[model samples]
Structures are given as structure tokens and as C-alpha cells.
Target: MNMTLTENTLVKDIVNELPKSSDVFKRNRIDFCCGGNIPLTEAAALADISLESLINELNEVVEKSDSGEIDWKFWMEKDSEAIIDHVISQYHNPLREELANLSPYVTKVSRVHGGHRPELLKVYELFYEFKKEMLDHAEKEEAIVFPLIKMLDANTVENREEALNAIKELEKEHDHAGSLLKELRIITSDFIPPAEACGTYRLVYKRLEMLEGETFNHVHLENNILFPRFN
Candidate 1:
């Protein structure tokens, strides 16, 4: 397959076809997950990147990927159970551990720096809210939504409506989480630490940035790939 990316290509489509394109998007800070429905041109404009440059990079990746120089699996090609298992192990478990470990860093950074950088306080508060919501969301997925999805996938769903409603609710929660992440990015100026930021401050910013990226990818898999299968 000879794939040449154009401005009209959707961000999500690129990621779906060439998963490694996600690394390029991540490097450019382009949202290819929750906000990935837009075209490449629009995404570039939003991120203030040159459309030509973006397209060139993506097309290069596509060529290399097509040449078998990269390992890219289409998640949509996987069975529902396989996809669910991947999400749980690759995203859910790591997210839980990271959130727990990063919580203290957020608190410590905010408490120590809030007096000087009021934004850290907001980061602290938002992180708390996000942590609570994400942990609950993951638990709900494992305990309720995921099981229901499995039933739906296996054609043994007793209450089809219930499964559909659960998926809808989870998507709504994803939107809320995405909004919180956007706010965090804005408040922290794209997670850039201040000039006098100490070791802990820098570390917190880095970890928070990583958290935002991972959450976006997680939501993307569910919102664009997994949930859409049942929808």
C-alpha cells in the first residue's frame, strides 16, 4: 500500500492506519486521541505547525511503515477481548500505578511552590480531581463497562440497552477528563516549568505531561476504537 498523507486526512485516521504516526503527533503536541476527529490541516493550524511539514513527516512514517521498517498493529483489527486485555494491561494498570505515584509529587510541588506560583495550586487541585475521576473511571470500566462489553462482544449480552448506556456514559466521562487535561495544559503553559523550578517541580511537570499523553491515548483507544465497535 502506497499511502501519501494529505491535509484532508483525519488525525484519527492517520493514527488508525499508521500507529507510529502517534509518535510524530505526540512530538508536535497534536491531539490525536480525544480531539482527533479533525483533519490534518486543522490540527496543524490548531497546533500552529506547518501543514506541509506535518504532512511530510506523516507521509514519511507511512512509507517506512509500509516498507516494514516499523511495527504497527491496527488496534481495530484486534478482537474485542484482545483489545480489552491490551487496554487493561497496557493502559489501565500503568495508569493506576503512575497516578498513585505521581499524587504526592503534585501535592508536594503545589504546597511548596503555590505561594510563588499560584498556578501550581490549580495544577494540584486539578490533578486531585483528575486523579479521583480517572481512578473511578478505570474501576468502573473493569467492574462494569468492560464486562458488559465482553458480553456484548460474545453475543451474550442480556441487557443490550444497559451495555449501550454504559458505553455512552463512559464516553461522556472521557470528554470530561479530556477537558480537565486541556485545562491543565493551559494552566501550566503546556506543562513548562518555571525558571526557578526545583528538581521536584521539574519532575512533577514532566510526569504530569506524561500523564496527560497516556490518558489521551487511553481515551482514544476506547472512544475511537473499542467503544465504536459496539456503537
Candidate 2:
């Protein structure tokens, strides 16, 4: 059974439990990824949306969603190793490929369109940093952090504090990633392509929008579900 959602519910909790509700938050221009720790009331206020309307929409979608569709809760039932394995296969591997695939389009759009739309220049720079940061973050997770997490799960780690600190750092990195995504949205005007946009230009924006959604779901799993196990 779905819990009664209220204005006081944490944004991440709602997204964590009812994944489809992210659509409602997204449509309302709410940040349900990085800034998801705040309450719906706070998020609604920040987005300048009607709290009642937001709650109603969230409830409607959540009600329409089958309880078995709760991926977040499903993952919660798994062991840390299982969760880590799934994250690697489901998010980490695909993210690396998607970022690489989207790179050329981001560059082409910025190079061709930046003269008239200077914001594309910023988008280019931000995406460059975002890409580099994400790549490095994933490397750290796979090479160092994930192994330690698995060890911690098995009670084989001698340095529990070190593992804990590493998890905290990952959380900080997740916040930075969320900030970069928010800036991308701001500069791209919520990923709405210009009227005169070329095919490649429009494609980049669409991909970036999809990236935002994927990254949100990715981070939501880590920040709210996986990381909390260590905390």
C-alpha cells in the first residue's frame, strides 16, 4: 500500500517511493534530484507552484502507479552488493556510453549556435566540466568506493571511518553534479530548443533532457537508497 503523501513529505522520499511522480515535479520545474531532500512544501514554494496543485498531481500519478512498480523500494530489499552491481550495470555503464555519444552533439550545437545564443557557450563549458567530473566520479566508485562498500557490507573492512568518509565525499560529488544539471537547465531554458534550431541542435537538447532524468533517477538511488545504508 502507498503511504499517504502530504505537503510535508520529503521530495526525495516521494520520488524514491513513486518514481513516476518525478514527472509531476519535473513539469513544475522542481528539482527532485539534488535538491530533493527538501519537503514538497519547500520545493513547491521554490518553484513558485501551488502547493495544493503539486500535491494533487503527485497523488494522482502515485495512485495511478502500481505498487509493484516501485523500483526504489525493490532495490531497498536487496543486499549492498546486489544494489552496487545493479547500479553499475544499470546506471554507471550506460552513463559512460551516453555521455560519450552525446559529446559530439553538444560540441556541434555550441560551435554552430553559440554566436547568436551565447548561453550555448556556457552550456558547452559546463557540460565539459560535468562530463569530466562524472567520469572521474564513476571511476572512483568502481575502483575504490564500491569495493570498500562491499567490504563494509561483509564486515571485512578494517577502516570503517575511511569508508564512511568516502561515502560522504560521494554525496558531495552528487550535489555538485546536481548543481551542474540545474545550471544546464537554466541556460537551456529547461531544454526547450529554439525555433530556428537545426536537427543536431534540437537533438542535443532532447538528449540533455533525457540525461537530466536519468541522472536524477541515478542519484536518487544512490543518495536516498544506497548511500543511506552506510549512513
Candidate 3:
């Protein structure tokens, strides 16, 4: 709270300076990743939240982290290739694995519970479509977007406009994926399990919650850090 924080500060900069501040932003449903360039005042307005309340929460988190506990900023300072590599290794690969592993559980849960809870059927359908779309999204990034970015980083001669356009397309895909996840959140009531939920039912929700968090961070890296450099 003692620091010179204000409404004009960039959301991404706030997250970079105080890594713990992401929790506050996430809790407030502020977009600190794709829409990170927006100022805090505007972001608060868009989220329909009080600016002062959000700033206070961010300051509190910063204060708590003053004990030298959570000092590591998330992926802000890395080079393009390093950032891309981290994205692939830390998020994309694991997401594919998780999707494959969780698909069965989702189907089983929906089949067993859909008799009473019709929502589970919708959940399974949405998740299946999301998985397929995300797989293709990852492939596009790996095959087309990421390589061009690395080329740009290396100063290699290529079609700059083409690469930029590809990045724009990738941003659109990110938005679509984000929208799908938001629908999933609404359908699952923020991934809360029912009173009659079985073990597999609970596990499906847990893995889904984890996937949502990781997907947010994954998109944050590309939308805020990687793409901006090329744009």
C-alpha cells in the first residue's frame, strides 16, 4: 500500500511488479493477460468493480508478499524463444495429456449422472468440443505462429505482415477458447461438485479447475508477452 500505485498503472505491469497481485486480479475477474495493456481504472470499470477496492486488495497481497515469500514474477522477463519453450513445455504439452486423461472421466460422469443432472451431458459435449478446438489451436501456434515469432526474434528476413496477421488470428483463437472456458465455468457453477457427486465426478471437476488456471496463464504469456513483442 505504501508504494506509488495508482489507477493509471498498467494491469500487466502491476502483475509483473507484484506477482502475487495476479490473485487479486483473478479474483476480481480483471483481464491481466490478453487485455493487460489497459489501465487499472478502465479495467475496474469494465469488470464493474470499484477501483479503490481492487487497488486495496492488490496492495494487501503485495504487503503479504513483503516477507520474501513470493518474489518470482511469472514469465515477464524471458526472451521470445524462452517464453515459447516454457509455454510448450509447461502448459501445452501437459494440457494435451490432461485432456486425454480426463476425457474418459468426463464421459463416464455424464453417462452415469446425466439421468438426473442434464447439465453433465452438456458439460461433456462442451468439453469435448473445447478439447478438439484447443488441440488445433496448439498445432497452429506450434506450426505457424511460434516459428514466425522465433524468426522475427532472430532477425531473419521474412514476410513481417504475414506473421503479424497470423498473430492476430491466434489472438482470435485465444478469445474463442477463453469464451468456451467461461461457458464451462458457468455450466459447472465454478467447478463445484454436487452433494451426490461420486469420486470420479469430483476428480473431473478438480482437473477441469486446474486446466482453467493453466489455460489462463498460457494465454497470458502469449497475449501479453509474446505477441506484443512482434506486434
lDDT of 3 by residue, 7-67 (tens): 9999878765654465577678886656788898999999999999988888776674434
Question: Judged by lDDT against the true structure, how good is candidate 2?
Answer: 0.83
**Ten residues in sequence with the least summed lDDT for candidate 1:** 64-73
Provide C-alpha RMSD values for all models, in order: 13.3, 13.6, 15.1
- Candidate 1 TM-score, true structure as reference: 0.69
lDDT of every model, 2 decimals: 0.83, 0.83, 0.81
> Which ten contiguous residues of candidate 3 have the minimum total lDDT?
64-73
Residue range 1-231, candidate 1, lDDT tens digits: 466678899987776666556668877989775678999999999999999999988877776442433222588788888888988997899788778767866897888789989999999989999999999999999999999999999999999998999999999999999999999999999988889776557667766776887788788888888888887
Query: Where's the lowest-lDDT run of ten residues in candidate 2?
Result: 62-71
lDDT (10s digit) by residue, model 2, range 146-194: 9999988889998999999999999999999999999999999999878
- Which regions of candidate 2 fall more than 4 Å away from where they truly are? 1-70
The TM-score between candidate 2 and the true structure equals 0.70
